[model samples]
Target: MWQWRIVGNGGYTKIQNVASGTFLDLFTGTSMPGIQVQGWARSASESQDWFLRRVSRSDVEIREILARDTHNAANFQGFRQDLLYLVLPKSVRDAIYVKSGLKNMKDRGQLFDSDDYAFFLKVEVAKWGVNTLLADDFGILWGVMFGQKGNHGLAYNFYLNENLDNIMFFDPYTGDEKVDMEYKAYLAVY
Candidate 1:
């Protein structure tokens, strides 16, 4: 049995079905112009990686992919793709894995429940004495739940917008290549 992992590469993704316990891989290591992608056993190299452009949405403005199906929880579940894109940095990811005693992003626990993980995410950033995230920075905050007036997955600005108040929040959702969110809805108070 192999534990599957989901990694965002581009318009497409490399994921192990969290529920199916299977890996989403390519048939083989074929780099031809047009090769099919499927699920298979884990390989020694990144042969399973692929790009999905035909089915992917065109409106999505991708800034970066934080992580893949990283965490599991009710509140956090809604933001896994967002959070994965948030905590995928090598230092930050290592810090969480070490402090939370998690071998990989699939591992879940109380620390990864909800707001707790968000807090830690912020703390990790502050640890480096960095504030005001850039486009590449996938910083998220535990803000007012939907219906209120804030965002839980506050991503960074992919590019400048005409309206100064409007900032773009990108989500690495498997369903959609990327989801554009209002930066104002994002709340980060730690």
Candidate 2:
């Protein structure tokens, strides 16, 4: 599914995929350790190139796939612990983070799902401040849209753990068993 080919002139190489013709791109803007290294539209960005390093007199090191049989590589396509969910596509996710829901129009001036993503996050946050039930209080009603071509695309839902200290959300994009909340962008998943 992947091909490591030689490209450029001065000892440069490019890693491309066979199924989708996209190249391995190391995100354009940021350089954080977990910055997304994804498959983006092939272009002349340095993120699309790789450098071969010589370790010893005879050892040349390149990429490595530690766990290859867990279906992780096939789904995510690459490795970046901080950006593990990038298999979902940053163009579809976001810039600073690969987040879902509506932050496009409200807080974060992002363009990924600007209108819809902002709406979804707004709904989730609003739910916390809203406590109006017909039998209890008063509030306005609202709704969300979900589909491939809707204002809000529903890939997953958010929930809290039993203790409520940390969030336990579900992301169809990330099939993770355990997620560290300290550094990663996505909340912990079941």
Give per-model CA RMSD.
17.1, 19.6
lDDT of 1: 0.36
Instruction: Evaluate all candidate structures by whole-model CA lDDT and list the values in order.
Output: 0.36, 0.35
- Stretches of candidate 2 off by over 4 Å are 54-190
Model 1, position 91, has a per-residue lDDT of: 47
Candidate that scores best on TM-score: 2
Clashing residue pairs, backbone N/CA/C < 3 A, model 2? 101-117, 102-117, 102-118, 102-119, 103-117, 103-118
Model 2 lDDT per residue over 1-190, tens place:
4565545536777777767777878877456698888887778777777785421110011012212212122322221112111011222222222333232234333444323442454354335324322222222111111222223323233222333222233332332222221222211111
Angstrom error at residue 163, model 1: 9.3
